[model samples]
Target: MGLESNSMPKIVIGDFGYTLEDVPHLSDFIPDLPTYPNPLQDNPAYSAVRQYFVDYDDTIAQNIVVHKDTPRGIHFRRAGPRQRVYFESDDVHACIVTCGGLCPGLNTVIREIVCSLNYMYGVKSVLGIHGGYKGFYSKNTISLTPKSVNDIHKRGGTILGTSRGGYETKKIVDSIQDRGINQVYIIGGDGTQKGAAVIFEEIKKRGLKVAVVGIPKTIDNDIPVIDKSFGFDTAVEEAERAINAAHVEATSFENGIGLVKLMGRYSGFIAMYATIASRDVDCCLIPESPFYLEGRGGLFEYIEKRLKEFGHMVIVIAEGAGQEMLSESLNQKDASGNKLLQDVGLWISQKIKDHFSKERKMTINLKYIDPTYMIRAIPSSASDNVYCTLLAQSAVHGAMAGYTGFTVGPVNGRYAYIPFHRINERQNKVVITDRMWARLLSSTSQPSFLSTKDVVEDSMDDKKETPNYALLENGFADAHK
Candidate 1:
């Protein structure tokens, strides 16, 4: 008896099973999925995995209904009618895992999925794929039961565990297929999501109908349309809290500057949003704007003046802020004679305070603080409660609607689906729109302390006299101005 289209798998919050519609294989859904060059056609790792896949296929592929198609999520198909159910006591199973840098509210996502899926549709066989994609192939999985996952709602890190690496191999797909893992939920940023797509393609080729769901998990909150990634709010709150504490210190001393850096690889959402949300920040440096170049001294000078006038300064910088504003007095270096660039937040603070102290002969004390791991991993604030739960519920809804190969991003404040593979497409870093830039420039009369024209330049031969303010008045440098 095949799963009839009319009989959708009924799913209620307290019910016993999820609603699944037809799911197709790659050739049926999107024929253009990249066919990888089978590097290890018969390697032991590949063989073992492939065998596992085929064995499972043999066990459930025929007469099993949901077992014969590809794991392309909810992509449309033109082939014969697809299997319409996800959890067949004989086949369907679910899983999740975390990977890469930590972000806030990870546990909430895991807890919601486990509880909802278990209670709603009896999709009780939820496994945690340990160590990201690597754990998938290594097959090091930890099972998550309703009981085990109950109290995880208030947790911070991923309870499912995570890894950072995996290989693109048929064997890996086959192993998963053999395990009856019909669906997988991955929580991570671009890299991990891209890996999920790769695995989806591989299993699709073999015609095992598995669904792959990706949750955009990054503290950077740079992923498009998601209206703030899972951990961004938490990270920003923590950063602001730290900045406020630093502000108190700066004010108490009546003559100090605090430079702080938040994480965002090539984006400025964290730095920009935190600065706007938390009013204590005097200046914010983001990858969207030039940091360590010439013409970038204005902000530093402006902050210095503020400290001199108002008694304290707080500057928020992105980790990827270019290495331009280093002062000649502070000795900074990396192993390669590169401008020693860790703790960029601190570097900016030091450079600005140093400029005023060295030039004005004022005792402008400085403290450089980089809350790299701290901000990212802080327990999510109360504000995250609503958003985190909503996002996790959204993923579940997307799955129930038979949607796949799409990312659920926030649009006009509502979560909407975007082409899923775009998660890895790497949208260009957010450029400061001319209008926004003008508003920022006009909003305050604070002139830039450092020029934007110069980046960090350290004399490789000598260690002293680092970070000089080179006047670089140009388009890129205009960000600071």
Candidate 2:
């Protein structure tokens, strides 16, 4: 029902190996900012709580599983209510906006933000900015209240609506200033968060009191620094239905092949997790792990082997997988500047048919299923609903307590506040060498799809590429210290 800080102490082991940066605050730029007792201290809803405020020094570690001799690494400020707040209840005018693509828990986050502000802090003047960042400048604002968004969480998509690539920092901040809006809640994916960071810089440059907070929204679960994005569980759950259908269709006919495509533009969490859950998939392909079609230890050879043994097989692939193998060159991008991906599911389906009917001189039945939209438009699962509620409430508490230019999400099962740059800089990808991938390989008994040269090159690249953000070892100050 409520959230608390992990309260991990900052431990610096070496001189040049670790850095911890804190999120910006209204007081950071403005001088002598006044503080008031948190409104929650008087609210009957939180009265029974023993500790109403999080410690200022409370933080969560970024790397929890390092070796005993390794450094403690980075830590983020814990997310919760602060004993003193900057804005008075009646003085706060907040607005919520959802950008980029649709995700399952968008409405849940929106509902919780409005409800928390109204019931928890008595901040009734909440406005919903329609149609992404452009809404701030072009569209009329919709007044939001606890009653207005009561049943929204049961539905899919954001009630405020969403879009992409309309981020003009000056105009959006102008709208905020003109309307006297001090709190801004932005919900979107990586690109949207990048835009949010720009907006925060612009606000700080203009000396505005606006608090810009981001809630990372991606069904792909690619946003880094968080355990998983909010709607990832729901997406994985919905993807299983498609995998099951593919399995039935494949098993029904002789030499049948079921090919299912799920969402994962850059990361393959959906396809990986969904395939593992189904336990019927013979192979799972993602962007992180390179795959080949021909030659020994190739996808085609594996498919042939599986078909020979089982008479039928299922394959699940992420949307972003197998781009290099495609004959067609799709050098295009969408509104958010994400590359338009060629359909790997269809390509592999055709490839499989050709390899059997044309190359191998054998007949094979192939079924292609693309349930990307269906999975993206459904309501969140029970667990996701609770997770979204916590994220939204933590965001509200942080904004009320004057934490600005940050995003809120769970780190190691504990909620924490992170700077926008830390998350937007790089994505959280599936590690091929990790235990999870090993488990998937063990379950499917599929080849790694990696050659000796690929393995050597990957190792060289890992050693050569300096981790600018992974450890945050350089170019940032130790804000927690």
Candidate 3:
């Protein structure tokens, strides 16, 4: 409870095309030796990754109460001397890996590193850590090459695959020590970041030379000060695609409600942004605003009002919108002091259906979840591409310059690499929503949803924008037409 500081670290950020004289190169996950390598469908590592870190069948529901008390906070390990040094010697090799959930632009990040290390800088011993940290210890190797990363800029999912359970054991920690891996780039979400910190702590504890650089890789945009995660734009673009498409369907059907959910548990940025970008979303629910029954009435009543006003409405629900009503997540234990993730998307949909059924006294048939996976991986959005590349470049630069305990984030729409010198420092952390983005979503019409100001009065500061209607001069103009 005594971690406090107020200065951002000035780490060196290696450039994509520019190289420094004193900078050290990172490792490539691909092994120098390649054999008839194939994958096992039931690789033991796969089980651990899905079960321990990234499983979809984990029976989640929209519960709001669980989101309070302990918010979704990521704990970073204080870096000593391991994750700071660069792998300059042949004895040391560096590789990038993704663990747990699939990020939108894993390929962008990995591609940037591969390009920078091999083409820009002199370091070319980079390897691809297949299946995440487990691959670091696995007997297999995925060496980097011009052929290996060819056309990866537009690909989705990790070519190396990912796992979540690799960091929970001593053997995994020792495997890095044995293999002489100097550093590992971990590109993943909260769970993977946690694993990165744990691995860093263990690697340093074992006196290993490997560095672990954790690039914020969630489409959820929940990570700090980076403003938005690498894949968030890609996911939002995909969501916008789906939402806009659904609007077409809603129009063609003449009288139907289309609901699509996005992947933001503790933040509504995705839901809000996607809605803003598209021309179909009628309402959006995010974690920052909890649902109320009595004072704010029910979501159904609001929907009914929208129906009365617009005949049909499209709703964009953030997955984490219902954290206030649910119990704490099992992962965030009783003593851990972390709140649970709420799934209000599903709840809001259900509540609408229930309300419609009662009000009309008829079975309400509606479409809600259009969860398209790997939207983060599609590599279509320019913002995501730029963001991923900046992160990779900054990561390499930060390492060569000796920066630790920090995550590279996007600041002012550019990669402003931030180091966590203080555990409880809020300045280094990215604010979820700024006035600029809020002003973008203030319109009552168009794709983005509008809510009663009183319902989210407490969060108004975070919601207000500088008001730039020029970009959306014709907000929801299509809807009226």
Best by lDDT: 2
Name the TM-score of candidate 1: 0.70
Reference-based lDDT, each prediction: 0.57, 0.86, 0.55
TM-score of each: 0.70, 0.90, 0.67
Q: Which stretches of candidate 1 lie over 4 Å from their true place?
A: 1-90, 169-171, 291-297, 324-341, 357-359, 428-430, 434-445, 448-481
lDDT of 1 by residue, 1-481 (tens): 1111121222212122221222322335444433322223323544565222111111111111244453422211111111232334324487777876677788888887777566543466888877766776787888888788777766666676655544544665776887877667778777666666666666655666566667777777666534567777778777777787777767777587776777776677777767766677777767666544223345545665686678877777787666444443335543212233455655555556566677667786676677878876566777776666766655654454344544444443554444444456553354564454334434433333343323323333344654564323342422211
- Estimate, for each residue in 144-220, the C-alpha lDDT of model 3 and write its tens digit: 86567977978788788876553434666676667766667778766555556566555555555456677876666
Residue lDDT tens for model 2, 76-155: 88999999999988999999999999999999999999999888888989999998989999966899988889999999
Worst 10 residues of 2 by lDDT: 471-480
Candidate 1 differs from the real structure by a C-alpha RMSD in angstroms, to one decimal, of 14.8
Backbone clash tally (model 2): 0
The per-prediction tally of clashing pairs is 53, 0, 38
Alpha-carbon error at 178 in model 1, in Å?
2.2
TM-score of 2: 0.90
Candidate 2: segments with Cα more than 4 A from true spot: 1-19, 451-481
